[model samples]
Target: MQNVYLAATSATPEVDFRFDSHRMSLKGESYPENAQAFYGPLLDAVGSYLAACRGTTIQIDVQLAYFNSSSTKLLMSLFEQFNQAALAGNHVLVNWFHDEEDDTILEFGEEIAEDYPALELLTQALV
Candidate 1:
């Protein structure tokens, strides 16, 4: 599968998914008007990639300064995919980055970690 790269906008985050490296990054803010329109294809691509993976390690880095509730739901679903993939034997690492001042984002990452315990979830303060 081809890599997926989406540039960030004022109301959306940047998405960089590298098929070859199995590395993905989502950065910037996210509050898109149509969350489904923005995340549907991205999720599909990720699902397809995980389905095709053969015990490869997948790394996902998330650095969102802000994201709306809709975006949160989408992220939850995305993490679910990571959990399933990891449980299936592929190593999956999720690095969730949050601003030092934003405890909410850090807490959110913790919640996701709790929900997807099978996946390796690491929360780090953004530098």
Candidate 2:
């Protein structure tokens, strides 16, 4: 499967995903006009890539300023996919970057960590 890379627009965040080498990242705000439409192919690509891996290491960096509830759900689903991949023995590393002043984002990261103990959840203030 090819890598998935979605560029950020005035209304969407950029997604830099590399599944072959297994280093993925999503950055910026995400409140797309249609959340499902925006995330559909992206999630499909991620799943396809994960299914092709055999003992691969996956790293994800999520840095978001804001996201709507729809996007939030989609992101959580995406993380769950990563969590499942880790459960199958794929080494997964996830670093959630939040601005120092954004307590909400930090807390959200913590909550995600709670849901997926198989993956490494790295929380650090964005510099």
Candidate 3:
């Protein structure tokens, strides 16, 4: 399967997914007018990668500055994917990074952690 690498612009977040390495990273602010349009294909790619991985470990790193409600929904969907994959015996790990001074980001990470208890969610404070 092919890998996905999407650079973050004003409308989207940076998407760096490597199939061979099984490393996925998303960074930057996302408030796109069409969230689904931006994320749908990426989600599809991830699903395809996971399917072909055959129980390979998927490490996802999420670093967001700000996101709108639509992007938030997309995020939930992504995390849900992690939870399901892990529950199905696939090794999935999620790391949510936030600026140490940004309490809102921390809270958002915590909320995500609570929502997906099946997957291991770790919080990292940015310097």
Candidate 4:
């Protein structure tokens, strides 16, 4: 499958999914006017990649300064996909990065970790 890369805009985050390398990342803010339109293909791509791989290690990094409610829901769906992949025997690691003082983002990450026990989640505080 081809890799996916989308530049960040004022209302969305950057998407870098390198299927060949088994690494994906979403950075910057995400408040897209059409959350589904923005995330649908990405979720599909990930689903396809997971379906085709076995015993692979996938690393997902999320560094969002802010996201709207819709984005939050889509993000959770993305995490769920990874969680399912992990449950299916793939190694799925999720790195959630936030500012040291951003309690909100930290709490969100904690919530995700709590919800997706199968995922190896690492919540990191950036300086």
Among these predicted structures, which one has the highest TM-score? Answer: 4
lDDT on C-alpha atoms for all candidate structures: 0.93, 0.89, 0.85, 0.94
The numbered model that scores best in lDDT is 4
Q: TM-scores of the models, in the given order?
A: 0.97, 0.95, 0.93, 0.98
Clash count list over all predictions: 0, 0, 0, 0
For every candidate in turn, the CA RMSD to the true structure comes to 0.8, 0.9, 1.2, 0.6
Q: Which stretches of candidate 4 lie over 4 Å from their true place?
A: none
lDDT of 1 at 87: 92
**Candidate 2 per-residue C-alpha lDDT over 1-127 given as tens digits, one digit per residue, 9 for 90 to 100:** 6777778987799999977678999999998999999998898998888888778888899899898889988988898998999999888999999999999999889988999888899998988
Model 4 scores what on Cα lDDT?
0.94
Model 1 backbone overlap count: 0
In model 2, pairs of residues that clash are none
CA shift of 24, model 4, Å: 0.5
Model 4 has a clash total of 0
Candidate 1: tens digits of C-alpha lDDT, residues 1-127:
9999989999999999997888999999999999999999999999999999878899999999999999999999999998999999999999999998899999999999999998899999977
Report the candidate with higher lDDT, 3 versus 4: 4
lDDT of 3 by residue, 1-127 (tens): 7878888899788999887898889999999999999989988887777666657778889999888889888988888877777777778788999998999888988888898887778999999
Ranking of all candidate structures by their lDDT, best first: 4, 1, 2, 3
Preferred candidate (TM-score higher): 1 or 2: 1
Task: Order the candidate numbers by TM-score, best to worst.
Answer: 4, 1, 2, 3
